[model samples]
Target: MDSMKNKIKLLAVTHHDKKNINPIRPEASQIIGLHRSGEVDVLVLCNPGSILIPYFEKEGIEVLTDPLEKKLSISTVLNIRKLIKNRDVDVLHLFNNIACSNGATAAIGTRCKVIAYRGQTGNVSRWDPSCYLVMLHPRLNKIICVAKAVENDLRKYLWGDKSRATTVYKGHDQSWYQNESADLSDLPIHDDSFKISLVANLRPRKGLHVLMDALALMPEGINIDVLLVGADSNNEKIKEMIQRSTIPKRVHAMGYREDAPEVAAASDVIILPTTKREGLCRAVLEANSYGVPAIVSDTGGNAELVENGISGIVVEPGNPKELADAIVQLYKDRAQCKEFGVNAKRRAVTKFNVEQGVDATIKIYKELTK
Candidate 1:
C-alpha cells in the first residue's frame, strides 16, 4: 500500500452543465469519497457558475469552472494546461467525449496520464473525424468503459489499442439502500397493486412504446401499475401512445424525481425494455440494491447485470409479447419475484458497490502513474 505522502493528485473534467442532473454525478460522488478517505487529491473542471460548483464545494472538493464551449476552444485548453502545470496533476480523468478530446489535447507533452470514461455502447464510424481522432489519441493512457459490451463495441468500431480499454461498472452508494422509501400514496396505485418502475430518460431507443404495447395486451384481471420516472423528451409521442393503449389509466408518468432510489424501493419490480444496447443500466443496479428484481432486455450489458431465472429475467429486445409474458409470470409468482429480489440485492452488494468501483479505478491510476 502506498503511503499518504505518495497520494495521487487527480483532476476530473465533465462537459455537463449543472442545470439538470447528469449521469456523471454518481462517479463524482465516488471520487469525492476517495478524496475524503485521503486516497487521492481531486479537483473537478466544469462549466462556469455550474450548479454542481456549490454542491461539490460544500463537500470541500475543489471545482474549476472554466467555460468549455461547444467547439474545441484554445483558451479552455490553455487554461487546463495551466491548471495541470500548477497543480502537478498526476492523472486527468474525463467524463464525456468533448472533455476526453479536449483534455487529451491539453495533456499532450505533460506527465498527466489521461483516462476517459466511456458509458455509451454506440458505434463510432471512421467517417467521423472527431471520433477517429479521439479514439487514436496517443496521449490517452486508458479507456474505462462502463461495461464489457461498451468495450467490445469500442474495440470493434473505433480501432483503438484494445489493451488500453478496461471495463469498470458504475457503482451506487450504499446510502441509497439505507434511505427510507418515499411516500407514494398520492399516486393512483393501491397497496395491493404490483408496482413496476421504468427509470430511464424518455427516448425512442428506450422502447417505452413497446412497454405500452405490452401493457395494452395484459389480461383484464392483472392488478398492476406502471411508474415512468424520467424526463419526457418525447412527451407528445408517449402521451399519444398511452392515450391509444387500453391501460392508460394504469400508467403514471411521474417525470424526473430526485428520490429515484426511494421510488425503486417502493417498487415490486423494475423494468427496462430498451431497444438498443446499454453501457450498463445504473437504474437496474439501483433497483437491485433496493432488493427489487428487474426484467431487462437482453442487450448490451443488461444480461451481464441480471442472471436470467435467478436474480432477474432477461427477455428479447423490442419484443412486447415476451416482455408482457415475463411481467405476468413475475406478477403471478410473487414468491419468485421475492426470491429474485433477494438474489439481486446479494449480487449488488457484493459485486457492484461504489467502493469496489473506486478501488478498481485507484488500481488503474496507480498502474499508469507508476
Candidate 2:
C-alpha cells in the first residue's frame, strides 16, 4: 500500500481464454506494462487456471481469481464494489461485455472511474435494453475500442457524450510469433504449392464460404493450397463446401490446433475473407507478425491492418472474383508477396507494437485520473 500510494490504481477484470491467449494477451500485457511503467499499481481478476497466472505471480501483480461474474451476478457485483472501496481503485478497466455490465453496476455511488473495452463491432443497440446495462450505461468514463471500426460502431449507439469512445488498437510483439513453423508434410499440400493459411472458425461471418468461392474460381494447375485452422473446419457443412468446390482436395480443414501459429508461419500467405462486423482479425495480425502477407476482405478494420498494395491485399467483402484476383496477383509475383511480408512485419512493429498500446492505455488512465 505504501509503494502504490503515489501511483494510479488500475483494476482490470477479464476472462483469460485458455484455448487461445493470443487475442486476450494484449489486454493482459498492458496491465503488466502499466505496472512496469511505474505509473500504475495494477491488479488483475482472471480465471485461476489461466496460463498467464504464473506470469502475473512472477511480476508480483495482485491477482484475484474471479472473472467477476457474467451479466449481473450479485456476488460478482458486490465483490467489485468492495474492491473499489477497499483498494481505493482509480481506474476500473473492464474487458468484455459481462465485465463491463457488472463493473459499471459496482461503480455506482463510488468515486472510481470506469472504462469499458469493446473488442468487436455490432451486437449492440440503443433500443436494446441489455445494451443499456453495458455500452449505453451513463456511468462509464470511457470506452476503449480495439479498432476504429469498433469505435465507430459503438459511437452509433452511445446515449452519452460520443467522444468518450476512443479507438486504440490492441497490439502485439513480433517476438511472440517467432515460433518455428510446424511440419506440413503430414498434410496433402505439395512441396511446390503456394500455401495460404486462415486461422478462424469456419462460420458465415468469417466468410469461409466466400473464401471457398475464390478457391474454386482459381484456374486449374495454379498450385495453391489452403490451410483452415480453428474449430468447425471438419463439420459436415464445411466438408460439403470443400467437396463441392473445384479445389476439393486443396483445402485442408484442421480444427483447433495448439500449433496454429506454427501452421500459419509455414504458409506463403494468410487470408481472412470475413464478410461483416469484424473488429480486427487476429489471424491476419499473427501472419503479418510472422512476415507473411495477407489477403483480407474490405470489411471492418481489415484495411487498417493490411496496407493495400504495400503490405497486403484488401478486396471487397463477399466478392469471390476480387478475392481470387488478389490471390492471383500475389501468386504470380512471389517477389511481391515476399515484399508484402516484409512490409506487413514492419507495419506491425512500427505502428501496432505493444508499447504504443500501453502508452495509449496510460494516456487514458491519466485523463480519467486527472
Candidate 3:
C-alpha cells in the first residue's frame, strides 16, 4: 500500500449529464473509496448540469463542470491538459466514449496513465476511424471492461497487447437493495398472480416487442402479469403490441418510476430480453441483488450472472416460446422459484460485491502509480 507520504493524483471525466445517477451508484462506492483511501487525490470533470456534481461534492471531492460534448475539441483537450499539468495527475480515468477519446488525446506526451471504461459490447471496429479515437486508441494504458464478455469483444478488434483490457464489474451490495417494496395495489395486477418485471428503457434493442410476443403466446389463465418500469415503456410500439396481445390488461406499463427498484423487488421474477450488445445487464444484477430470480436472454453477459436451472433461466433472444415456457415453469412451481431466488441472492453476494471491485481498482491504480 502507498503511504500518506505520497498520494496518487486521479483525474476522471465522464458524461453523466441528463442520465439517471442511480445506475452510477455502484461506481460511486468505488470512487468514494479511492478518494478516502488517503493514497489517491481524486478530481472529477463532468457536465455542469449533472446531478453527479452534488453527489461527489457532498463527499468532499473536487468537481469541475464542462459540457465535454465533442470528441476532438481542442479546447476540451487543452483544458484537460492544463489540469493535468497543474495537478501533476498520475492517472486519467474516462467513463464514456467521448471522454475516453478526449481524455486519451489530452494525455498525449504526458506521463499520466489513461484508463477507459467499456460498459457495452460491439462498436469497436478496426475499419472505423472513430473507433481508433475511442477504444482502439494506442494511448490508453488500460481499458476497464464492465464484464468479461466486453473484454472478449474488445480483444477481437483491439490492437497489440490484449492484456491492456481488463474486466472489472461495477459490482453492488445487497445492503443497497434492501428497501421496502413499492405498494403496487393501484395497478390492475392481482395479489395472488405471479408478478414479472422487465426494467429497462424501452429501446428497440431491449426487445419489448419480443416480450409482448411471449405474453401473447402464453396459455389462457397463466396467472402472471408483467411490470414495464422504465422510460418509454408506454411507447407507441409497446402500446400497439399490448393492445394486440391476449393479456393486454395484465401488462401494466409503469413508465419510468423513481421507485423502480422497489417495484421490481415486488416481483416474483424478472426478465431481460435485450437482443444484443449488453454488458452485464444492470437490471439482472439488480434483480439478483433483490433476491428475485431473472430469466434473461443469452446475449452478452446476461448468462454470466445466471446459472441455468440454478439461479435463473437463460433463454435465447427473440424466442417467445422458450421465454414463455420458462416463465410458466417458474410460475407453476413456486418451490423452484423460491429455490432460484435463494441462489440468485447468494450469487450476487459472492460474485458481485462492491468492495471486491474497489480492491481490484485500487490495486490497478497502485500498480500504475508505482
Across 307-353, the per-residue lDDT of candidate 1 in tens digits comes to 99999999999999999999999999999999999999998888887
TM-score of each: 0.91, 0.96, 0.95
1 or 3, greater by TM-score: 3
Tens digits of per-residue lDDT, candidate 2, 226-251, equal 88887465488878877755787888
TM-score between model 3 and native: 0.95
Predicted model with the maximum TM-score: 2
**Tens digits of per-residue lDDT for model 3 on 1-370?**
5474487889988776556766887777778778877778899998788777777899999999777889878888998999989989998999888888888999999999999999888866798898878899889989999888888888898778998889987878677787888889888887699999987565778887778888888888788888988736448866786776678888888877876778878999998988888898777878788889999988888888899999999999989899989999999999999899999989989888887787788888888878
Residue 133 Cα positional deviation in candidate 2, in Å, after optimal superposition: 1.9
Ranking by TM-score: 2, 3, 1
lDDT of each: 0.82, 0.85, 0.85
Better of 2 and 3 by TM-score: 2
